[model samples]
Target: MCVAAVSTVQPVLAQTASPAASADKVDQLIKLLDDPEIRALLNKQTAAPAAEADTSMSATEFSALGHRIRDHLRKIGEAIPQVSSEFMRAGGTIADDINGHGPLGVFGLFLTMVLIGLGAEWLFHRIASRSRMHAALAQTDGARQNPLHSAGRHLFAVLAPLVAFSLASLGLFMAMTWPPLLDAIMLPLLLGVIACRFVIRIARLVLIGPRTGKDVAATAGLVPIDRASAVFWYKRIFWFACVFFAGWALVGVMVALSIEPGVRATVGYALGLGMLLVAIETVWNRPAAIARPHGRGAMEWALTFYLCLLWGLWVAGLVIILWLGIYALILPGLLKATTAMARNAFGGTPDVPGSGNPVVEVLVERGARAIIITLAVLWLAFLINKRSSMFTGEAMTDRIIQGVLAGAIILLVADILWQIAKAVINRTLEHAQVSTADSAHAARNGRLLTLLPILRTMLAIVIALIAVMMVLSGLGVQVAPLIAGAGIFGVAIGFGSQTLVKDVISGVFYMMDDAFRVGEYIQSGSYKGTVESFSIRSVKLRHHRGPVFTVPFGTLGAIENMSRDWVIDKFTISVGYDTDINKVRKMVKGVGAALLEDEELGPLIIETLKMKGVEQFGDYGIDLSFAMMTKPGYQTTIRRRAYMMIREAFTQNGVVFASPTVQVAGGDSSSAAAAASTVKTAMDLKKLAESGEGA
Candidate 1:
């Protein structure tokens, strides 16, 4: 019985196993083989070949970029009808909202919010009207008073109403419930409106300034641009803001409507073209006073081409290249314009010495620069995030983009710090400028002047090095190794260039010791001159005789500072032996008194010139020692004047300067007379020869 049953089961199984059943068995077997280990093994086997295929495909795509661009353009052209439909649909949505099918439709709700906001803004404006008027009036006298204060007041006055409007509008919008579609569209629109209005108001304040009276000429704007330029820019900027905000709102609406990405890109390109045209128009037709001169039309054409290239890059979705071009073309001009505007607003005339507040000027300038750079960095980050896959090798592109953004931020921060440091150092130097008027703090001022420049240079180098290192780290470089290598290299260099190290070290010590300062006369070995300036390793010495020497600090040993405190000058004057000592002393005293009474020389003299008895007996006569103490650098002049006065006094008082005398004894009178005559003739001949030689 068991044998018969087995035989029957085998036949039945064979009959059931048809082709479809076999195929099902094979699929089950494949599923059983699909384990993680087996899949990983298969991937490993095909990885190299897949990578090669991807590389080839990337190369092909790169080679056919123009074709792709053309195809994209064709797609954009074909989607024009769809784009129009989408825009019409968006308009219809707004229209439907305005038709009041529901309570407080989008349009009515927006209108109510705007009206409330405007009313709030109006109330705020009325409340602050007196302050605003005062700020406006302050503009006329801004240059005479504190310009920063005036600018701040005006800024506050202008911003108050806008703040009130923003708060009211945002509060109302948030408080009301909105449909998802209308919510998305209305929020961006409202925000864009508020932002646009704020931008326009602030731009107007900066460019057109406050206007209290009817005459536009009375406007004292922060920037020194002429009224025509102000008006032109104000109008152009207004239009630009309108277009920008409108495009922003449109993009949001299209996004809410689920428009095709290609159509959206096309619309964006169109808006960009509009912007480009506006820029071109502004560039070409700018006021002559503010416009760059294009005498040969080269600059204008170049600018136009550059702008078009930027647009093309944008169209091609080459975000990196587009941003690089923008930064290259725009950053320097923006920085310069911002700085100039800040200086003109908060500072006095740029060319005038000590005219402006350095702190305020640098703060405003660097703050503006920081804002611009931050905005640019943020925009670039957004572009990278949005178009990360626009380039091949997405990982590398992301890293590069991140590095660039970080580097830009690092540079901006470093620049702000450097500018602030530079401003402080410069201001200190300006205050430390040596004055001709004698003051107790002259030495301290000179020392400050001498050391601050080197400190500033060193500080700049340190900031630059640190910023570069941070940027390298951001770029994914092994900064630890680089830093170690730099340290080693610096050590090697220091060892190799011992003289430079010595000079630098000596200079530092010299500054610390305050041995010599700028404008002080010092003598070291054979080098004697007035300190003109200082460098890291050397001091510039300007000689009294009009030669400049750059002497290494290491070479300057045992410095002799001649222009410190007071200088006592002494000289010997021989007088006739027959002169009365008492009378001569009295005459010298009179001369000293007269010198002290003189207007020009009186202040220079610390102690009047005095005759210090007989210094010694000379062959000609007795040598009287004359000494005077006077301020440094004026001692020589006073000594010269004293010599002249003494000579005049001696001549007037019949006190003759001594001369050589010879007496002939035990000789005939005629012989003696002849001898004297011969001596006199010889002396006269010698004097003539000496005069001739002098000439």
Candidate 2:
């Protein structure tokens, strides 16, 4: 609408009473030729429009037609003198006619000036006045900057949108009636005033942020460029406004240049985009100044300016890409450095002795390494971009070359990091000097060994299955069909593997319950040995004599961990039953008393150890059972030491150790005597046989 209206601006420019404005707007030359000097200027620029040629004519025909016309004209005695008059009448020969010199021309020019240009000017002045006035009121006085004043100011600003709404009816009426050039700006303008209330809101959150709203603006360094930002906020608003304005302007230009419209648009857009990119790069990567231009603004202002600049936005995208690239480059090296730094900072790995503050040290090393890698990667990527742009030629070939160069840089950097990581891991392994890995890894290996075969089977199965799925998916099999097939297959598998599943479930519980742990001697399923490995399907044991046995968990229905809880130990002394049993009890009590006072055993023993009494009375000796509660796994050592102490104490008391014995005695009858005795007692023998069921 605007450019179509340019015919309107042209007349307004030509007829303008002000000489200076007309001088600057030379397109108003028809009206401007009212000035005799400008008329001469228009005459010098005059040129004839080309004559129309017939569409059906070929080049030769057209040339022949043109020759025939010239010959006819010559026959009619045609010359420049007569042609000049016709051209003059047609308003091409004379300069005064160029700016439309007729009285009707003057009326048309004046009318257009009033309709569009003058009308737009009037609205411009009107809105500009209102904008200025609104800003003035917002900045009334700096005296009331305290909380109470701030509160009051905020309350008033909140009410301002309502006030603007009331005046909007009048503004809208004027807009509807006059239909000004910028009716589009009115709604956005009103909404913006309401938004100012939000800026004031920042002042209330002083706990975590700055106190003054001006501080935010100061941080943005927007104040010097705009004293009225508190009221106007024009900087942010104008960008949005201009974008719509440019869009409207673009449409107008496209309409005017419609003959070759695509070419025009493509060229304009490419050039515009290129310039924007150049501008963004220039400012975004610019070195920070030694000091602020005037030291009157916060750092945020500089950053915001950089952010808003064209180059800054363009490079900001590059920054993220560069950062990711660098991370891919340097992150592996940094992670390796982190692990090494962890060992150094903590004195060793967490499981190793003297590895102090392992948790904290490990975290700091890893976190710091991650951050450092990230920053280095970003910096390196930026360096590459700058160097490539500067050193490379400006050609399509240059872009490809730069891409190759960047890929090479990333690959080379990543390869170096990989080498370093390998070195670090190797060094760590070397220091341990184990035929196998050290205790930490031994524990891990023990865990993995327990799972390896089962995991190996599971992984192989899963990989094969996934490959099948991939092949199906590659053929464009729908997920629904695959999932449905999986569901059915799972049902079939569940039915087929029921016993195995049951074994796995039971095994998991047994292992988790500490029914048996690896390296602990245990008896389960009539098989007794030290536990070698425990898996979902099976349990493994290395027996005392050196045979390894694998038992399915389903068969391991019962378990007894001899190594768990405490051991009930008994030692015998000959003649102990007759030799003052009460004194013997007191002597064992003394032993228990001494053990209770020991520092290490004191905490481990939940209850005091005691001799329960002589459990068996025999002809030669009495057997005693000593009972004690000991820490799990430590019970074996505790029981051994306690038994040793009992033996030493009993021997000192002259108590001789006793052993169990058996004696054979002669019966009432031997071979012949038994036969005579049985003959006399045949009835008794028969009764005996009957009692034995005829045996």
Candidate 3:
């Protein structure tokens, strides 16, 4: 009737709006009345019609559907009175309908069921204990090994008792065929038990995690808490909360079963107060599992942030106590299964130590999590669609769901990409470690390792930016303004941090040019040390005396690598003029040849030492210079060893070292004594020189 009325109005309005209602306008308006699409559009613009036509169902079919629904409802309405009279007759008693037995029979049945369930659980536990499956779970952490299998172990550990209880509850349900006991006691007990099991298992998992390793078992456990505190919280606060929440749910079931409103309200208030207490206790015993980042005033900030986050999580936990009754019981097992699948698909054992591909591992783990979370969200959305009336006719709900799904995909893709980049970089560094003794090869490896951190940072930034943009797009947000803002921000940062930019760019160029590799001893002005590592803006050089100098690439000038290529050392040796010059030269040459033949120093020496005879004629002696080419950083040791050998050879050959003498005129006994003293002084000097040389 409403659709007909609206259809009548649109044509009249369209005709009246035109000054002249031509034949064309009349025809168009008449066409609109017959067109279902036009009527549907009009219905959307106006109020919805009382009875909208179902194009799929004919008039006769729609009538049949309505009749069936009315008939079913009529049957229910008719049965309600009958059920009420029977309920009144029973008067909520625990009496059996068949024998008129009271509470004793019901209690006996309950006890029997409990024993049966307990017996079954015990038998199963024993079998599991002896099984190889249990041994596998005991040995491996199972995260990277077999996620599904590990998850199964956890699920079995947590859910086995619950499953047994459920079976027992089912038996009790069947045995208590008497309506009164079934309605009043059996139903409430069953709900309470199930709710309690879920709460307890989820709480235990959250507080201490699955029995994997002490550390891994605490992965999802309360952070920053000691074992004692964890035990205390579990026993004192969490257990209480679980029991309270379960009992509260039982009362809610009672309320649903027509319990007194006053009693229900009282129980609700009590539950609320108990939950508040639990939240307070949780805050008081905040876990110390997470560490604060190092910085000035960081601890305070971390504390504040974690406290707020913890409190919020607590509040959320309370709010979802009933909801968890749905998910907490099932999602964990499913998550484990999905994780196992991912591990099987993407995980592998590395062929060598440190060879495991982190990319594949991260991608597998994160991808599995994302997939599980996405599926879980979608599943939840589907449940909400079926159970909730809020989104039944709302078009915006669909848009929101789409937006959420889009954002998830964008984030997932970004995460996978980031993981891939990191894996590539890590794999490169791993391969680079196999470099040989060749300088170029080692330098290449060093440069590759040095570039990893910077590349990771760049990749992260790019991936994050893309992810943000894609997520915004998914959410129907305009990206143009954001892009413009980002550009402006970049310019501002570029200008404000010019020195940082310059340093980073200089470092980048230095890496590209392969100026100096890590571990090479290089000198830049006065500061010379071994290259320990490289950062985005600076290089760390460890000095010989254990000081680390962080030199910015921009500040470096004229780099001299002392550890590269060959080094030539030249030094002069002074000898007595009366000494055999050819013998001394032959001796020096022999020293170099002997050094080249030496097993320890042979590899370091590039060329034999050669003499430039009689480099200079000093007043005390004739100076001869010799030079030898050796590997970089080996020159000092080679020079020292060569000189020592030469001095020893000279001493054995009786070669005299040069010494200064003073002349004295001989005329009297005093003059003769002075000349004797001068001669004795020369002899003493020669002895002193020999002693110093030997020492």
In order, candidate lDDTs are: 0.84, 0.51, 0.68
- lDDT tens per residue, model 1, 204-271: 88788865557756666677777887889888889888888878877876787678877888898899
Highest lDDT model number = 1
Name model 3 segments beyond 4 Å from true. 1-116, 132-195, 198-227, 255-266, 276-445, 467-477, 484-509, 523-559, 574-582, 585-625, 656-695
Colliding pairs, model 1: none
Off by more than 4 A, model 1: 1-47, 50-61, 64-71, 87-116, 130-145, 167-170, 271-273, 289-296, 348-356, 394-396, 434-439, 662-695
State residue 241's C-alpha deviation in candidate 2, in Å. Answer: 16
lDDT of 1: 0.84
How close to the true structure is residue 82 of candidate 1, measured as C-alpha lDDT? Answer: 83
Candidate 3 per-residue C-alpha lDDT over 260-340 given as tens digits, one digit per residue, 9 for 90 to 100: 444444445446556546544544454443332443355445544554454343333222223434355446855665455
- Each candidate: how many clashes? 0, 7, 7
Clashing pairs in 3: 148-340, 223-287, 223-289, 224-287, 224-288, 224-289, 225-288
TM-score of each: 0.83, 0.32, 0.54
Error of 1 at 589 (Å): 0.6
